[model samples]
Structures are given as C-alpha cells and as structure tokens.
Target chain A: DVKVTQSSRYLVKRTGEKVFLECVQDMDHENMFWYRQDPGLGLRLIYFSYDVKMKEKGDIPEGYSVSREKKERFSLILESASTNQTSMYLCASSSVPSYNSPLHFGNGTRLTVT
Target chain B: QKEVEQDPGPLSVPEGAIVSLNCTYSNSAFQYFMWYRQYSRKGPELLMYTYSSGNKEDGRFTAQVDKSSKYISLFIRDSQPSDSATYLCASFTSGTYKYIFGTGTRLKVLA
Candidate 1:
C-alpha cells in the first residue's frame, strides 16, 4: 500500500512561532500537495510541488509555503504562525496530476496555535 | 460565488438505508468530478472519480455526473455504519494540479 507519513500527529505552538510540518511518501509520486482542513470550509490547498525544487501557490497560499527537496518528501512551512492558522494539515501524493488519479494521504497533523 | 458548493450535512440514516450525497459546480472548465471520504481525525481519501457525464459504479457506490446541470452525485446502496464519514466533492480542469472543492457533508449511519 502507498503510505504518506506525516512527521507529527499533533502540535502546539504559540502565535508567531515558525512551524514545520514534514511529509514523506513511500511511493515515487511526482505530485505532492499540502492542504489545511477546517470545519465548514473543506480542504483548502496551501501549496503543491510537482518536482524537486518546484512549488506552486494554491488557492490559499498566503500564509504558508512548501519545500520539496527530494522526490519522496515534501515539507510545509509556516513563516509565522497565527491562531487563525490552527487546523489539520494533510499531505497527499499522486502518481499523476489529474483528479482522476488517486491521492494517497497522510493521517494529518492537527496544529493548535495559541 | 464559490466554484463548488455542497450542503454541510450531518445527515443521519439507519443502516441499510440508501444514501445520496450531492454537490454542485459552477465552473464550466471542470472536466472531472471526484468524491473523497474522510473519517474523523483522519485525512480524506479519494472514493470515486468520473471524467464524463454519466454514472460510474464500484461495489455498492455509484457516482453520477451531469455537466449540463453541473451536478455531481454519489449514491451508496445499503449503507453501513462503517460508511460514516465526511464526503467532499471536488472538480478539476486540464493542465492544472489544483481542484475546486465543496464543503463536505458529514454522514452518520446508525445500526
């Protein structure tokens, strides 16, 4: 089975702290994505990487950034965390870029910014 | 207006009930529709995806799409308690890695 492993399951950080959420996929997928899930807003894309050193801003990328230094790993970074950024962060990898391709996802890391 | 819209339903149903989940999209450029299921405290997983305007079935689940009305539907026959989860609908166009998603519908199947 394809597994997307997130480095953290839960995190607690104070406002203005820089946060790093790491993800690693076992499969050799070319597409990796970061999304934040909030109640009533669904999952909003933060950023995505198509290959190493290549990243694109998504719909809600204002406060977040991503780094893909290797084929299997993608990392989401919060330059300066805020309370509004508290949410469940998910990492997903897809063999193809299309919605038709299945996106294998990590369990998620719930962030609590106080 | 939101590109995709769905009712945020905490729809409760008895086991063995047939469940219907729906979403609407306003983007005419969306070429594919997809459904993702998410359990509590877990990440969403892709359940169904359809590229054309028709019904596609897998096991007890059927995914239907109508481009004319820009409506998408996922039907579950004989729903089980294990099927309880939040269902999210998404749409995508060609040459892009992003998807327009609707707010999810939460379902609870009671035994």
Candidate 2:
C-alpha cells in the first residue's frame, strides 16, 4: 500500500505569519500535489511537482508556493498567511499519469489563520 | 462555466436504501472519470473510476459515464452508515496529469 503523510493534522497561525505544510510519500512517486478544500469550492489544486525542483502552478496558486527538494517530499509554503488562507490542505501522490493509477492522498492538515 | 459541475447535496438516506450521485462536465476531451469519497476532516479517497463511456461495477458500487451528454453517475446499493461521506467526481483528459474536480455532494446514511 502507498503511504502519503502530512506533517500536521491541525495548525493555528496569526495573520501575516508564514506557514509551512509538509508532506512525504513512501512510494517514491514522481508526481506530488497540494490542494485546499473549502465548502462549496471543493478541492482546488494549489501546486504540483512532477520532479525534483520542478513545480507547476495549478488553478489557485496565489498566496502559496511549493518546494520539491527531494523525490519523496513536497512542501507547501504560505508567504504571508491570512485569514482567507485557512483551509484544509491535502497532499497526494501518483506513480504516473495513467488510467489505472489514481492519486493516493494523505489525511490532510486543517490550518486556521487567525 | 465550470469545467465540472455537481450539486453539493446533503442527501440523506436510510440504511439499505439506494443512493445515486451525478456530475456533468463541459469538456469533451475528458475520457477518464473518477469518484472519490471523503470522510469528515479527512482527505478524499478514490472510490470508483471509469474510462470512456461505460459502466463499471465493484461490489455495491456502480459507475456510469455518458460521453454524448457529458454526464457521469455513481450508484450505491444497500447503503450503510459507513457510506456517509462527501462524494466528489473528477475527470481528466487522456495523456494529461491534471484533473478537474466537481464540488462534492455530502451524503448521510442513517441507520
């Protein structure tokens, strides 16, 4: 079984503070993604990494960035956290882009920016 | 228009009842369709997947896709309390890594 682990389950930060959400996958998958889930908005991709040091912005990448220094780890960074950035963040990984290979996701981190 | 559209339903059903969930897409290029189930405070997990236009069944779950109308459906038979969760429909174009997701429908199966 594949294991995707997010570093934190709950987080609280003050406004204007920088926040970091970390994720690690044990399967050495080549693709990693970060998404935020909100009521009525569903899950929106924030950023994705295809390979080490290679990152691509998804639909809603503003106020956030990503790091992929190693194949097994991907991190999402909020330059300046705001109340609007509070959300349930999820991390997912997939071996490759194929019909049979769906993404395996982590439990998620619910961040509260106050 | 949104690429994928789904009613964010808080549909309530009694145990052993049949539940149906649906999604519609505006993109004709999407050939891969998927349904994910998300428990409260947890990440979404893949529940069903269908390729092109067809029906695929796994145990009590069935997934159907209609390419002509760009619609997808997921049916659950003999639903249980454990089946209470948010259901999200997703789609992707063949050969692409990105997927578009619909707003989830929250289902509550009462015992």
Candidate 3:
C-alpha cells in the first residue's frame, strides 16, 4: 500500500510566524501537490511540483510557497502565518499526468494561526 | 460560474436508506469525473473514477455521468453509519494534472 506521511498532525502558530509543513510519500511519485481545504471552498491548490527544484503556482498560492528538494519529499511553507490562513493542509502525490492515475493523499496537517 | 458546482449538503439519512450525491460542471473540456470521500481530520480518498459518461458500480456505490448535461451522480444503496463523511466531486481535463474539486457534500447516516 502506498503511504503519504505528514510530519505534523496538528500545529498552532502565532501571527507573523513562519510555518513549515512536511510531507513524504513512499510511492516514488513524480508529482507532489499542496492544497488547503477550507469550509465551503473545497480543496484549493496552493502549489505543486512535478520535479525536484521545479514548482508551479496554483489558484491560491499567494500566502504559500513550496519546495521539492528531493524525490519522495515535498514541503509547504507559510512565510507569515495569519488568522485567515488557518485551515487544513493536505499533501498528495501522483505518478504522472494520466486519467487512470489518481492522487494518493496524506492524512493532512491542521494549522491554526492566532 | 465556478468550474464545478456541488450543493454543500449536510444531507442526513437513516441507515439502510438510499443516498444520492450530485455535482455539475460548466467546463465542457472536462472528460474525467471523480468522487472522493474524506473523513473527519483526514484527507480525501479517491472513491470512484469515471471517464467520459456512463455508469459504474462497486459494491453499494454507483457512479453515473452524463456528458450532455455535464452532470454526475453518486448513489449509495443501503447506506450505513460508516458512510457518514464529506463527498467531493472533481473534474479533470484531458492531459492536465490539475483537478477542480467541488465544495463537497456532508452526509450523515444515522443508525
């Protein structure tokens, strides 16, 4: 079974603090994604990386950035956390761009910014 | 209009009752439709996947797609308490890794 592991299950940070969410997948997938799930807004993509050192901005990338330093690991960074940035962050991995390949997701990291 | 639209329903049903979930999309380029189920404090898990249009069944779950209407449906027969969760509908354009997801419908199957 493929496993996507999130480093932290719960986190609390103060405003203006920097936050880091780590994700590691054992599936050896080439594509990794960071998404923020909000109530009534669904899962909005924050950023994605198709290869190491390569990243693309998604719809809601303003308050977030990502890094893929090595295969099997992806990281989401919040430069300055704010109250509005409080939400559940999810990490997912996929093999490639194909109809048959679906994303394998991590359990998620719930971040609360005060 | 949003690319994908789903009623953010907290639909409640008794155990053994039939449950229906639906989603509509405005993008005609979307050829692949998928349903994901997310439990409390957990990430969304892919449940059913359909390409183009038609019906597919797995156990007590049935997925239906209608390209002409740009609509999709998921039906759960004899719903159980364990079926309570948030159901998300997503659409993918061919050749793209990005997927647009719906707001999700929250279902509670009471015992």
- Give the i-RMS of model 3 in Å: 1.2
lDDT by residue (A7-113, candidate 3, tens digit) is 99999999999999999999889899999998877899999999899999999999788889999899999999999999999999988877676777899999999
- Largest lDDT belongs to which candidate? 2
Q: Write the residue-wise lDDT of candidate 1 on A1-114 in tens digits.
A: 889999999999999999999999998999999999888778889899988999999889998888898999999999999999999999998877664465678999999999
Q: Can you give the TM-score per candidate against the true fold? A: 0.94, 0.97, 0.97
Interface RMSD of 1: 2.0
iRMS per model in Å: 2.0, 1.1, 1.2
Question: Which docking category, incorrect, acceptable, medium or high, applies to candidate 3?
Answer: medium
Query: lDDT per residue, candidate 3, B24-103, as tens digits?
Result: 99999998889999999999988998899999999999999999999999999999999999999999887777889999
Q: Itemize residue pairs with steric clashes in candidate 3.
A: none
Off by over 4 Å in 3: none
What does candidate 1's lDDT look like per residue over B1-111, in tens digits?
899999998999999999999999998988888899999999888889889699999999999999999999999999999999999988888677877789999999999
Per-residue alpha-carbon lDDT of model 2 for B7-81, expressed as tens digits?
Answer: 998999999999999999999999899999999999888888888999999999999999999999999999999
Query: What number of backbone clashes does candidate 3 have, counting pairs of residues 3 or more apart or in separate chains?
Result: 0
Give the per-residue Cα lDDT of candidate 1 at A4. Answer: 95
